[model samples]
Target: MKAAWLITIAPFAACEPVPTAERFIPDYRGVETMLLADDLVQFNVSMTNALSARDVENYAECAAAGYTLIRGWGFARHLRTNVDEEAGVWTADAVYTISPALPRGISTIDAEVVSAACAEKGIPTV
Candidate 1:
């Protein structure tokens, strides 16, 4: 009797909704970039739904590469990235240094190549 009662109660329990394919793509607009200085720039990307750090980082890199090219540069080097979550919104604030030639840094990308890829993917830039 107790076993049957437990099974009946289990059916009535409130359960969280399982994640679906839609959740994988957060309600994120594209990337936003700001020119803080001639060589220094800031990038921000945010999503309404829950997202992982990797998603935000990907958004930032896409933005930086495209922005560098948009500014008539050929390379971009990562400076820093800040991640935060507020009231369900996840945000990543990233900074980068852009240059005509490859910057003297380990973390750098060929802006032309990356930006072209980003454009093909329909990612926005500043």
Candidate 2:
């Protein structure tokens, strides 16, 4: 019975030990600038009339996935136009601002992926 218990515990004993303060040091230099901000950031998002809810969901998802430092309230506008007249037609738009930083070691492919994901959600790239 003792032998069986030892055998069962042997594998668990081989697990690595948890790290301590001495072994793990926090790095603050990389985040110092972001910790201090004086101005608000903004962005503009515009979409076609056919925009769907999925697009908005995707935009929010992308924003969450990215490295956003700050965000601000957004404004939107809707316009109407006549088919025959191009000059008099008013335009519709939406504006929102978010300050995001590129994570260290982020590749171009990562950016493209994020952009595409946002586009899929209906968030236009600025």
Candidate 3:
């Protein structure tokens, strides 16, 4: 009978592997910040299924800008960023020097302005 077969299949259903949704990124995914010194800070950002390296790098930059502003600094000098991709997750680890003015290099950013732009773009910051 149909009812008998339905009951038999119901027990077998629990043994089946559940399908996981494939996504470009998880909800509420973003960056984390750490301060190594008064002027030096680190940002690590990770996202699932990002398609481009630029997106990962931008995440770190956004974190750096927001971190600099929250520390009461107006400028940030990019130190370095290490990017990696594994499976479907992309990660960028970056460091920056926070200051009141450009650090005499080509790698300076305005914290207030950049952070506002990052916020407008929906990137998370500290």
Candidate 4:
């Protein structure tokens, strides 16, 4: 019985002390304020393709000219193509985020130009 008791208590003896709440709490109010401001003035956009680095730069340039944000994703093709190609039917999708205040007409042109540029770079788009 004494040996059993020692075995149980030995584990607790080596436990580390818990930190106080003050040590873990962060100044989140500033972050929250920034997020709120961003919500008011940011736009969201995306593109789907399989373009190489040079192609991506071209797309980025188009996006910048139109005042938007952009990113890319990978998908499968009938045959292996770019670095991101997989075995099955997959595609790469690029995304962009921009401010909401920009003119709506330019946004459409932005999407067209970026999509075309990606295609020219060997990145397919639907």
Candidate 1 regions exceeding 4 Å error are 1-14, 119-123
Q: Residues 17-126, candidate 2: write the lDDT tens digits.
A: 97566433211111111212322222222222313433333333343224232232222111111112123221222222223333333221243456566666444443
Q: Summarize candidate 1's per-residue lDDT along 1-126 as a digit string, tens digits.
A: 999999888866747577788776556666777889999999988876545777667678888887787778899999999988888778899999999999998999898787777677655555
TM-score of 3: 0.74
By descending lDDT, how would the candidates be arranged? 3, 1, 4, 2
Question: Tens-digit lDDT track for model 4 on 1-126?
Answer: 999999999999889688666543221110000112321222122233323333333333343323332222211111111222343222222333334333343323344455557556543332
Lowest summed lDDT over 10 consecutive residues: which window, candidate 1?
Answer: 117-126
Task: List TM-score per model, in order.
Answer: 0.77, 0.22, 0.74, 0.20
Clashes in candidate 1: how many?
0
Runs in model 3 deviating more than 4 A are 1-28
Better of 1 and 4 by TM-score: 1
Where does candidate 4 stray beyond 4 Å? 1-109
lDDT scores in order: 0.80, 0.33, 0.83, 0.33
Number of the candidate with higher TM-score, 2 or 3:
3
Report the CA-based lDDT of candidate 3 relative to the real structure: 0.83
Instruction: Return the TM-score for candidate 2, rounded to 2 decimals.
Output: 0.22
- Candidate 3, residues 7-60, lDDT tens digits: the string is 999999999887567554443367788889989888889976666878888888
What's the C-alpha lDDT at position 90 in model 1? 80
Give per-candidate clash totals. Answer: 0, 5, 0, 20
Best by TM-score: 1
